[model samples]
Target: MPKIDVLAPRSAYDIECETLIIGAGACGMVAALSAHQQGEQVLVVEADAVPSGSTALSAGLIPAAGTSIQRAAGINDSAELFARDIQAKAQGENDQALVDQIATDAAEVIDWLAQAHGLPFSVVSNFDYPGHSRRRMHGLPTRSGAELIDALRARCEALEIDIICERRAFALFHEAGEVTGVAVSTPDNTQETIKCARLILACNGFGGNRELVGQHMPEIKYGLWFGHDGNKGEAILWADKIGAQVTHLGAYQGHGNVAHPHGILITWAVITEGGFQVNKDGRRFWNEAQGYSEAARAVLSQPDGEAFAIFDERIAGIARQFEDFKKAEAVGAIKSSNTLEDLAEQLGLPAQALRETHADLPLGETDGFGRTFGDVPLSAPYVGVRVTGALFHTQGGLKTDTSGRVLKTSGQAFRTLFAGGGAACGVSGSNDSGYLSGNGLLSAMVLGRNAGKA
Candidate 1:
């Protein structure tokens, strides 16, 4: 975990509430809002000045089935289908009951956030994310996580829930082995104990902690960490101290193409639309169709820890719908050339190597990396983005039940202790390859609402 300060003895309670939430991300805010809606007093504390966690860095997509939106779109879906999809992608290594619960509750939670809470979410159609059989993803009008967080924060404010920002929660406070509250260190370096009837650990995972990353997920330990700095795995560490069972510690979401210097996420739509990645040596290294999270491993193992996303104008037009793509283009993160030789000269790649690579783009022709480019050859005017792999967020932490109660090693619920969002072990199972798109927020919002309701 990120280096936490040793605490001094707490003398008295600084605040008390019915429900205490650690972290102000989507999960924490949703939990707080849900609890407040139920007429319970809630308090949320954030480690940073504002409430942007990895959720704010995401595309704000949440997968759900049987929602009003889905039904209105005439797409048939069921919780069973959603659970099966998750199990298929996670290789059946997930908690079955939790998966079922998330699938069942996802639509209701998102629909509530939209209709009642005024968070404008609409079902996105005509496209498919990796590991989903149908169009089950819902996103904001802006398709930005920052906007989603703002909506949740506004709901919390409307409920008059207290949110303490820039305060770091260090440890859990317990009485007679029952979790009761949290110990927080404020910006002034003073220790304050906030006692509560229930505690929700939403402090995210260890993507930013080098030691924890090496210990749990050594495969991507050396990859660039692209998550929030405040995600120091404190929830995992503190819950472990209280005998909380940790599961799926190696699971994470890895982005294959984070445009360098510009730092904008290069959408995988480029690859799905017939774009290919090449090593710094100007050669295909792996099947680009493996999806982003899985392809990250191949990208990291490249010759110089670098790769380039090469696509034609047709694919670029398809990808321009994403805000990150628009921003990347605005910042000059993408370059274009009308010819392979000009493209090679502009990007410093081998012209002959690039030309030869495109010669075999016909259907049923497999490249050296076992990739079949069935979409025919890429058009003349080419677009390319210099890219690198990055760890976006961890999908593992404290194991919880269907209702979001943190479970002990003996399989009993830890009384008064709850976890969700990045603080909870997710549906991604035991490794990075199992990560399906939108799994992070699915686990977060579903479990967060569950914890608050319980």
Candidate 2:
């Protein structure tokens, strides 16, 4: 329930700006910076007391190809290869034009952040994400989303950009098909209307809205919601009122291995680095190599809708690079033992079944689930963490052109409206299975930059 206030000609406003952006996450922040770089006075309004959104909850990793970092690391990748990876993972269900646009613009965005904003970004060359054919994942030194947001916020501060926090935008005012201003309310119910020549919506999607999630993504409706609470689909609602085109409302990014009860994310690196998941009965159910988004459904279908991620010390060392994994270890969510039997006893799983499952791991050959294990088997000192599925964020919303202009139902662009991040339809196709790692931030930063530059 968001409403659009139709305005007459020559309406006055208490405040004004050349470019106004809603939501202070990666998308909005980047848009603000890009607009400012273009000599446009910009203002950003955030719903929460701070700028933390779904971006802060993530690993802060962005996948980009053909960057200077990639070249320095001697890795060969191109925008075309990245687009093919996205298409192959989504099974060709996504818009090829949109995919190509993001893929092509991603490297430039990454380079811009580093060169202009002084963000210390480097490519992650250790291991490859599920769908990526190259090691193009990039992150800061800490590999933390909070760090990324902090860096962007610092840059905004240095540039003297104005970001107003604790202002929740409730209504959009427009004349005909062109947006004129937005109405925001404070926590104390004080309301103000700010006029702008152009408006960008980066408030993210509806994963946090229970009603909308149940309506569109009922399959993961009952699962855990791990996204920002302020993501209530207000952007999508406003788009609907304005007749802006929306598509793939059911598409979302989900995770199969969130530490249960601890509410901490166990990095998917453990799984990709030779770890396996088992139900309470200690049995492998599906092909875990199919990507973490699809694993949400596979894990939810298990007994009690819960499972345990089993890995060895070597894998744990690799996962230590992630801040979430360290937090998970701090809270005792991760359990380690010198033997599988001891680890099974600690996790309350059947010892015999756990041993048999471990013994059955194929070496140099694909298993029944089509995952091939390496020649090196998991040695002693086993580690495990109790996990459950979670819906991270919705991938579908208002459809926009490559320049990030919101499009009408008749395929015409709105005069002064643009959208990015979760507010716009992503390249994940129509389901969770199509979500490649880092696709969320990929869309957020790329589209946000494009929208501002346009």
Highest TM-score: which candidate? 2
Model 2 C-alpha lDDT per residue in residues 50-99, reported as the tens digit of each score: 89999999999999999988898899999999999999988999889999
Could you tell me how far off, in angstroms, the CA of residue 188 lies in candidate 1 after the best superposition?
Answer: 1.3
* Local distance difference test scores for all models: 0.85, 0.92
Q: How far is candidate 1 from the true structure (C-alpha RMSD, Å)?
A: 2.2
Every model's TM-score: 0.95, 0.98
Which parts of model 1 are misplaced by more than 4 Å? 1-12, 364-377
Q: Please give the range of 10 consecutive residues that has the lowest summed lDDT in model 2.
A: 1-10
- How many backbone clashes can be found in candidate 2? 0
Tens digit of per-residue lDDT, candidate 1, span 146-242: 8888888888887788998988887676655577677777778887788888998888888999999999989898988888988888878776566
Once model 2 is optimally superposed onto the true structure by TM-score, how far is the C-alpha of residue 375 displaced, in angstroms?
A: 1.8
Q: Cα miss at 412, model 1 (Å)?
A: 0.7
